[model samples]
Target: MSGAMRMLAGLYRPVESQTPYGGRSVTFEAMGSAWLACGARRRSERGEGDEHHAVETMSAETRDDPRLETGRVLRFGGADWGIVTVRPLRPGRVGLELERRR
Candidate 1:
């Protein structure tokens, strides 16, 4: 598999966890571009709490599809971080599928 695919595939592995709400599937996406690293957390239906992570939406010309972009801001930690194009691959699978310019 390609480097990008390998990174995503590794992250897609099923993980077991328990939250205050209840037990739910662990779904998350992470990507690194240059010196930036961003990620997003999917909400678990089993839990009533709001998802802590947030994402954005974007459209691509080469790829005619919509995707969710996850990101956040942190001043204390370091530079501002942001997510750019996140899309669902299937029912319970999602990840980044864009090329970042250097």
Candidate 2:
């Protein structure tokens, strides 16, 4: 599913993951090129706790995705972002509401 979808997708960007390697160590792995939305959190409507901080909702494909999880850290566009919520959008796709982690 991803192979065909990736080939057909026009916009692609980079996603980096930090995984715990041996309980006491961490390793950063680069998963090249993903289809995602990266931008400022919408101001039209927001829930409690969202208004105070600058955040963004990043949506990406879920199929074969191992980089997104609760408490997981990701680097996009040279900044660190923490995974706040990973929501399944539809077949072969998912949406990640990320909070900027400084």
Candidate 3:
């Protein structure tokens, strides 16, 4: 199970989170990354969310990592996004629910 995940590790984007070091200072730390499978969760029988877009699309599958915690800001590609859920899938893997910070 875990071996399957390891096979795809190279596909994941590296994400980082900053840790405060002192006054007005911080240090960047690696929070790892996951292969994101992006998609829009449909609101109804149609296909995608047409009206209520604020309700996040729910079907983003990601490579499971333990560090993917809710409320943590992960920096990806020079942008930061907040984690909404870190769901455990099979052993050694987790699904990450993320939302862009405003």
Best by TM-score: 2
Those runs of model 2 whose alpha carbons end farther than 4 Å from true positions after fitting are 1-33, 42-64
| Candidate 3 per-residue C-alpha lDDT over 15-73 given as tens digits, one digit per residue, 9 for 90 to 100 | 44554753343344555556655444333332355743333324345656655667665
Report the poorest 10 consecutive residues by lDDT, candidate 2. 4-13
- Per-residue lDDT tens digits for candidate 2, residues 13-80, read 33445456634434544444445554344423344774554445544444436555666656655656
Per-residue alpha-carbon lDDT of candidate 1 for residues 7-98, written as tens digits (9 for 90 to 100): 11111122357888886766344322221122332322332477443333222211212223443211112223233455655564454433
29 Cα displacement, candidate 1 (Å): 15
Ranking by TM-score: 2, 3, 1
As a whole number from 0 to 100, the lDDT of residue 17 in candidate 3 is 53
Off by over 4 Å in 1: 1-5, 8-69, 72-82, 98-101
How displaced is residue 76 in candidate 1, in Å? 21
